[model samples]
Target: MENEKDGELLSYSVTLNSQVVEESKELIKSTGGKLSPILNNLLKKWVEMNKVNSENKE
Candidate 1:
């Protein structure tokens, strides 16, 4: 499948809290969603919010 990565993708592994993972899995299933875009959007929003807040504080 074509991804937002423009056909080039990277993979890595990390350890996460099992409880967090389970909760996230339930949320994803309930939403009928996938992980990649959700995570990407969340990270993007986090960065944008941080930038805006920093600017406000400056």
Candidate 2:
């Protein structure tokens, strides 16, 4: 499937800490933010950081 502008999409189920999830929901609601974008940005940053670390290690 395709995303609005990010091209293809993949679905994965992840387990997160309950407390953190609750806190994140509250923060998102208070700030009028959407969860998907927040998660996407976080995962993208994590992937980039890991890639850089792996390259440096090689």
Candidate 3:
């Protein structure tokens, strides 16, 4: 599948604690937010942070 502007989409299976999943779901629901975007933002931040760290080590 292709995202609106982020290119191709890849699917992966992940496991998380059941309690955490439920709590996150509730929080997202209360805020009218979806999980995909939240996860994407978090992953993007992680990637950017790692890139900066790698550059600093060079």
Candidate 4:
């Protein structure tokens, strides 16, 4: 994000382990920029699985 009014550039750095990242570059090349929805779906599945696990413990 950039602060256009102040002419300042804002950015955030996310640190990730390469081996765990699954090299999405290849997927991007194949899908041609449709990765956002796929990522959202995966995150939804992760949250559901976490909820299921917590429920089982109780």
Query: Which predicted model would earn the best lDDT?
Result: 1
Question: RMSD in angstroms, all models?
Answer: 14.7, 13.5, 13.8, 14.2
Residue pairs with backbone overlap in model 1: none
lDDT of each model, Cα atoms only?
Answer: 0.49, 0.47, 0.47, 0.45
lDDT of 1 by residue, 2-57 (tens): 66463333211112233344455566666665557868467445555655554454
C-alpha TM-scores of all predictions: 0.39, 0.40, 0.40, 0.39
Q: Looking at model 3, which ten-residue stretch has the lowest summed lDDT?
A: 7-16
Candidate 3: misplaced stretches above 4 Å?
1-35
Clashes of 1: 0
1-58: candidate 3 lDDT, tens digit per residue? 2463332211111122333445555566565645578675664455556555544544
Clashing pairs counted in every model:
0, 0, 0, 0
lDDT of 2: 0.47
Task: For residue 32, give model 4's deviation from the true position in Å.
Answer: 21
Error at 7, model 2, angstroms: 38
| Model with the higher TM-score, candidate 1 or 4 | 1
The Cα error of candidate 2 at residue 16, in Å, is: 20
lDDT of 2 by residue, 1-58 (tens): 2464332221111122333445555666665645578675674455556555544544
The TM-score that candidate 4 achieves is 0.39
TM-score winner between candidates 3 and 4: 3
